[model samples]
Target: MSTEPDDIVARITEIVAAELGVPAEGLAPETDLRGIEGADSVRLLRVVAKVEQVWDVELDDADVFGVSSVADLSAVVASALQVKA
Candidate 1:
């Protein structure tokens, strides 16, 4: 997979941190998104929506639902960016 830009990763991390109410530093690429303390389907989708706003990209629902970890979501965002580019 293509590596995402650092700025994109930072923005995504910020969105996740904000939506999930966790410190950005606590969100590693490998962190289990569903395992996070307050994460649920609705909250997760909200995070995805924030990412879409930040990156100006819409991700496939299939891809979003398939993501199990932050790395997976990052990859999906990176792919969406690539498509937009």
Candidate 2:
């Protein structure tokens, strides 16, 4: 299954929001994941894990930790999917 960049961002926003216990509607593509009120290392990692699960791709540790905003993560996921393809 192929996921478009916008779809990746939306799904990731949902995952991050769920993990951080915030409303998904409150998140924007430019929103920094680390800046979220309840965001912590473990919670952010969970979001990464969920993204990996949903997309069935393994993101590099460097890429995962390097991402700050939802858009950044979406770009990384798009790159990973490209590599997989």
Best by TM-score: 2
lDDT of 2 at 46: 94
Worst 10 residues of 2 by lDDT: 1-10
Candidate 1 per-residue C-alpha lDDT over 9-46 given as tens digits, one digit per residue, 9 for 90 to 100: 66677788889899999888778889998999899999
Instruction: Supply candidate 1's per-residue lDDT for 31.
Output: 84
Query: Over 4 Å off in model 2, which ranges?
Result: none
Per-residue lDDT for 30-57 in model 2, tens only?
Answer: 9988899988999999989988999999
lDDT for model 2: 0.91
- Please list all clashing residue pairs in model 2, or write none if there are none: none
- TM-scores for all predictions: 0.87, 0.95
